[model samples]
Target: MRSLTVVGPSRVEWREAPSPELQEDTDVLVRPIASATCDLDRRLVLGDSPFKPPYALGHEAVGEVVATGDAPCGLRPGDRVVIPWHISCGTCAECGRSMPGACRSVHRLASYGNTAGGHWGGLFDELVRVPWGARNLVALPPDVDPVVAAFCSDSLVDAYRTVSPPLAAQPGATVLVVGGTASLGLLTVLSAVALAATEVFYVDRNPRSVQTAARLGATAMLITSYSEPVSGVFDLTVDASADTEGLRRALKSTRPGGTCVSRSVYFTEPALPYLDLYASGVTLVTGPPHATPHMPEVLRLLSSGALDPRPVLAGPYSYDEAPEVLRDPPPGKPAFAHPRAGAA
Candidate 1:
């Protein structure tokens, strides 16, 4: 099997790897129908992230089951499924409480692509071994367009997980979104609108993303000058921008007694305005999204056609072109479909 390997900064290549076998009766093998570069993958590939190289390079993929072990899983050989980015034992204490991202059975960070995550080999592989298949695989409707549906493995649902809670608490609240490099920023803008924010304001430096935000129903602005205070104005604010300056602006934008959620993972410590944050009595949320907990709600929204991720689709790259596309994943998150997956 061929696996996409990231050798170093801006260098990606294909390497022959042994096909994964079913080590347990519960094991299953899946061939990815569609996959895309995730936010963390984009940051590490395009910039200086702490992750080292020579590792299999992707974690977001929607796949077709090709083989199943003798154990009876509700799934069969032809079912399509979303492979979660993090590994979890559905029976564990933390997992039972909906904290699979911090599952105790495996290393706290165990996942497919990154080295810190037990190096389970990325979803970019031709064949992926899924342990505890029944627990891990989330079956999709047969009619799903794998290209738009691919992000269920990570970002798309994560976007919903970020905005849902705050909006649920205060329906029709005004929202301010600070966006930067990751596709999550754009998706969050879309999610906020779908969740019925009374007003949505998006601030980003990227012209392309700002335009996309407009099409998705948000009032978009390209971040130019933050000389004036933009804080204490919005009921809820999301900071997906990896930039420090943007994060502070987002935090400041939250109204007194409102909420601000940040989804960026940064290596260097960002300087924060503690006094201002303290004075506002604002609620701040920042951490790994427990994606599984919100899957049902997000999947329902997508399947119902209430939300559309198609506008953010950049490409359906040929399987062979995956390495290059992923090296610097496009502004709109790029999706990859194997020719065998029936790409139109």
Candidate 2:
């Protein structure tokens, strides 16, 4: 099997690897049908994150079941499932609270492509393994497009986590999203509008992403912050920009007693203004997205035609092109189409 391997900073290529197998009765071997690059993946490419080289490189993928061991959940060959980015025991206490991203059974940062966890390879592999298959794999709806499946494995679910709870608490609230990480902020706009946020404002320097957010129902703005010292009121503010200044501006724009969610992960200790947050009574939520519990709801919205992320998809490139694309991915969120959909 050939897998995308990161040899060093800004270096990636396809490498041969032994084919994976169903290691346990509850495990399954899947062939990726579609896969994509997430914000975290890009950070690693630039050597901005802590990961070392010579490892399989991907986290988000939608795949077809090639073989399944008989244990309990009756998943069969040909069934499609979205591979969650984290490896977790679905029955753990943290998972019960919808925090599978912090499962106690595995390493705290147990992800497919990272070094902290055991090397389980990456989603870009020709064949991937799913542990505790019944709990980890979210079966795809029959009619959902394969391309949409790839991107939603993490991006859409993370976006759902960013806005769903806040929007639920304050019905018909206004939203402001600061995008820089990747598709996350744009997807947040899509999720917010679908969930009944009255007005949505998106800020980003990338014109392509700004336009994409507009098509998804947000009023896109190119400015990161107000030039004059006027605070624009917003019911909720989400900063997917991993920059420190961007986060500062996002906090300044929030209304008192409103909610602010920062979906970006920081590699360094950023100096944050705790005094302002305490004084304003802002409800702040920031962490790695625990997307396990919300995948079902996001999939439901896609199945009903309420959300279509295909507009943001950049490719269905062949597997032969995976090396170059992973090395130098095109603008916007891109997806690679694999012929493994018919691996059965």
Candidate 3:
């Protein structure tokens, strides 16, 4: 088996690796049909992030079950499924509390791609072993395109988290998404719109991004200057921009007593407007999303035709192109597919 491994800044190579095997009765083997890169992966490839190199490079995918253990998982070989990034036991205390990302039964950060969690291997590998398969895999709807659902593992779920709960709590709420993290911001915009935000306002300097957001029904603004926050407040605000200015703007724009969730991963701590947040009584939430719990809603939205993430995706590149394409990824999110999985 050959897995795409990030060797250093701006470099990736196909490394021959041992194929994974089922280790538990609840385990399953899957062949990745479609895998998408994360913003962190782009940063690592561009030499712009803090994580060191020589690790497996992907965590998002839609896979086909190659084999299932004897545990009666209601799944079978050839069934396509959405593989969540986190490795959780589903029955753990943390998972019971809806925090599967911190499942106590696995290594502290147990997940695929990053070995810091455990050497669970990458979704880009030719084959993967899914532990606690029944709890971790979500069967993909037959009518949905696998490539369109590839990001369901992480990115889509993360974006969905930013807006879904808040919008549900405050129906027809106004949303402000300061986007610089590429597809995440746009995906967030799409979710807000699909979930019925009365107004979705997106801020980004990229013309393509702004244009895309506008096409998705957001009041998109291309602001090269972020020294000032967008005028007016919103019921909810999101800092999808990986920049400090963007975070500050999003925080300041939150309506009094409203919530602002920062989806950006700041490797280096950035100075924040503490007084502004305090004075306005705004609640700021940050951290990686608990992807598994929120996945079903995301899929339901997709299945019901209430959401379509394909607008923000680019490329159904062949698996053979991963090493080269990942080195310098495409403009929008890139989806790599197996030649035989019949991905679109």
Which residue pairs in candidate 1 collide? 231-252, 231-253
Predicted structure 1: lDDT? 0.82
Q: In model 3, how large is the Cα lDDT of residue 263?
A: 90
Q: How many backbone clashes can be found in candidate 3?
A: 0
- Top-TM-score candidate index: 3
Winner of 1 and 3 under TM-score: 3
TM-score against truth, every candidate:
0.95, 0.94, 0.96
Cα misplacement distance, residue 273 of candidate 1 (Å): 1.5
Clashes of each: 2, 0, 0
lDDT of 3 by residue, 1-344 (tens): 98888888788888989998888899999999899987877886776765577777789999989998888898888888999988999998999988888899998878888765767888998899998999889988877778878889998999988888898898999999998877999999999998889999998988999999999999999898677658899999999888988889998899999999999977788898999988999999987678878888888888888889888888889988888888767778988877765743
Root-mean-square deviation per candidate: 1.9, 1.9, 1.6
Candidate 2: stretches off by over 4 Å: 224-231, 340-344
Tens digit per residue, CA lDDT, model 2, 175-285: 999887668888889889889899999888778888888999998877644332324779899988888777776787789998888888888887777888888888888
lDDT of 2 at 266: 86
Give the candidates in order of lDDT, highest first: 3, 1, 2
